[model samples]
Target: MAGNRAWILKSRPEGLPDMSNFELRDIGAEPLEDGWIRVENKWLSVDPYMRGRMNDVKSYVPPFALGEPMQGGAVGKVVESRSPHFEVGETVFHMLGWRESAAGPASAFNKLPQMPVEDHQWLGNLGLTGATAYFGLLRVAEAKEGDIVFVSAAAGAVGSAVVQIAKAKGMTVIGSAGGADKCAWVRELGADAAIDYKDGPVVKSLLAAAPKGIDVYFDNVGGDHLDAAFAAARQNARFAICGMIENYNAGPPPAFRYIMRVIAARIMMKGFIYTDYMAEMGDFYRDMGGWVASGAVTGRETIHEGIETAPDAFLGLFKGENMGKMLVRL
Candidate 1:
């Protein structure tokens, strides 16, 4: 039986994900079956990694099956349970498919501790994206006090969090965003300055903003933007290769001449994935959650209403349409 709403990947894209790549199916309820709980979806996260998942090649993760429900991070309330561990009316987050409803084993979901939806989304912030920033900046970039740090995608989910976290650690933060408004948003997040990447030649602007060569580069947008960061980095600078949002929607692999700058300038460049550091999360959650509660660290999110619009919301990340974390309200 088809329900009223589910976003299915009608086809994978050769480049950007447009509305035509997805099909909204009106799937009604399916039987709970044994040992399964049926959850009414409430919120879903739209992230950059979803772009890579659309490809047919093997990667660190599996490709999303074509013509099936595409899945990402989601939260929902259990309306019915056939398992012993969960009861009705409990909320949880899981790798559930995109829809108005989902069914899975109790073990398939993690029970959300009592907290605001924002806090429950710690699974999102302090979860994958947070860990990405944490390990990337601290361990890979080797962030130090008084370092001049530049982060691309500075107003999106991970970038917003990176600005505050670096600020808290006593670094001078400069951010790069797609527009003037997002530039202002990043400055409000405590970055010392924010450059608009859209304003022609990010390299020239970044060089002008930092004046002194950049000590750390947290690259969320690669390609030309990364090329710019390289031009501005100081000797022995640290580069944390996080995501390449700029080129994710299209393009050939970026040129590597700039990477030679890393060796010539003695810059340290490293790439990291969050799943590699799940073991250190207990400590990060305690430290970072405290910073958030104390107002020392803050996060922002752009919420799009309705599961039907989730694809549009996700596609928005490529355009810098979101200010902070992007979520879809169900």
Candidate 2:
């Protein structure tokens, strides 16, 4: 029997994770079992949410067990199948990531739909990241035509999608990113204004960009970004709180000096996870899929080659190393 290589959690990270927290080892593959399929992972997604799962605390998703392979999103090809639902050579998307291969029940994998986009995109655009942007902006934030929408981390996967979608919907878009290049990319994505947050205070930059105030905020990076959103929100504005990458690593929460603006402005702020709108995924695919095909929405990826570099890819998320989705190709 051949061996499989997998990354196992060596220890729980205290603050920022390091290579020391992970261990890669070779283990023998189990014999094929009935009602199961074995898949060779081709691409794995490394996202900000995975940082929360690293903690040894209870949350929406269970924590990764010590000395075990951590789970994530992966796109793979089935090599062996004992289940009628899947066949050899078929491509599938599953949650058993961070390893070279996975063998599990057919129900654990979703057959990928044939699309013009690349297969790895199933882990990003047209997948979780895209869905998060669609639901957060259109549904949760209740963004509408002529609304001025501000998105933090505007060069990231979810935030980039939000900017493009808002533009397509006849909304005025204001985006904030860390560097001049990222800000330019935001503008190229159809943002009415792009603020380089590295220049100065985010609140000042946002206020300057949208002097009339903003009607919607798609928050991907919290901290000063959240405080800036509150300060820039117009009366009766809507805020869709998505991932808070700013505070993902263990640190003291940002002191929000503008929180009182939420009350005074009567802003409606709500936090959401994409799974909460799974019932509406079909709608998202129908809309976002068309936009992507028509070039109205652009999807980008930063791929880290080889499974051995997965730890660096995941760590890169905190360093603003990726402009879009961060992925590891096995």
Candidate 3:
């Protein structure tokens, strides 16, 4: 009588998504096909990028179909395997999420290697969020030691990782968060200063935090934060355009007032996806793994229990409800 519990896209959200847009359904067991495996997801990722997939629009990834189970990032166990590539009890990271269980071709999953970290850590510091921070700061932004780096959403998942990694690499980091507590946490992550964006205008606070101007900017919240970065950028500053959580639910707003500064400051801003570095996975694992083991970096998480709570966790990303990576423990 056991069935897989899943959250389906009942309808496309108009402005801000609500519970009405999601429906919990039961996916009954199905016969396994050759070269396929059945996985029971343990940890599900709730990210800002998933918001774009809710709308029926052209993007880096396809939109979630109506009345179908949604997908994001998930790490699970192989409960049943009909493929040589995967074995029963093996841990795997896959794209099939927003559900308790899924049966798919073995090629759809990556068999996780034996690691000293927790199983969920593969979904956090060693996962997409961590990789995003790593590539964005080091590769995209070309951040180096002695650089003054500014990161928005510094207490959130990717931003927090950028703060820690930048500090560990000997760069002076300034982080901005929405609240006093979140700002304090950013400071604890080794940022030279933490700007509380809610306290006043981000530009004013950022200018005060780094009077000399920042050599690099890692952006998460785009609207005012991007404006602040442009105003506070040093000559030839580099920017890694990460997520724009502000405009995710809201339609694209007008360009930043300081948009013209890109030419004035000779800034180089680039947007990138983590998958673009698939060839460097080994390099990422080695460096990030050592940093994690040496305590030079840490992964923080805010978890919601059960598959039914997944929608709420996803919804919480825009509301600033999570300190680090928001995850659902199924």
- Write candidate 2's Cα lDDT for 1-330 as tens digits: 277888899998988999999999885586788999999999999889999988989998999999889899999999999999998999999999999999988889999878788888888778889999999999999999999999999999889999999999999999999999999999999999999988999999999999999999999888998899899889999999998888888587778999999889999999999999999988998998899899999888888999899999999999999998889999
Among all windows of 10 consecutive residues in model 3, the one with the lowest summed lDDT is 250-259
List residue ranges in candidate 2 displaced over 4 A: none
Candidate 1: lDDT of 300?
74
Model 2 residue 214 CA deviation (Å) reads: 0.8
User: Which candidate number maximizes TM-score?
Assistant: 3
Q: Which ten residues in a row have the lowest lDDT in candidate 1?
A: 115-124
Backbone clash pairs for candidate 1 read 2-27, 2-28, 3-26, 3-27, 3-28
Native-to-model Cα distance after best TM-score fit, residue 118 in candidate 1, in Å: 3.6
TM-scores for every predicted model: 0.92, 0.97, 0.98
RMSD of each: 2.2, 1.1, 0.9
lDDT of 3 at 216: 97
Q: For candidate 3, lDDT tens digit of each residue in 156-239?
A: 999999999999899999999989999999999899999998999999999999999999999898999999999999999999
Over 4 Å off, model 3 = none
In model 1, how large is the Cα lDDT of residue 70? 84
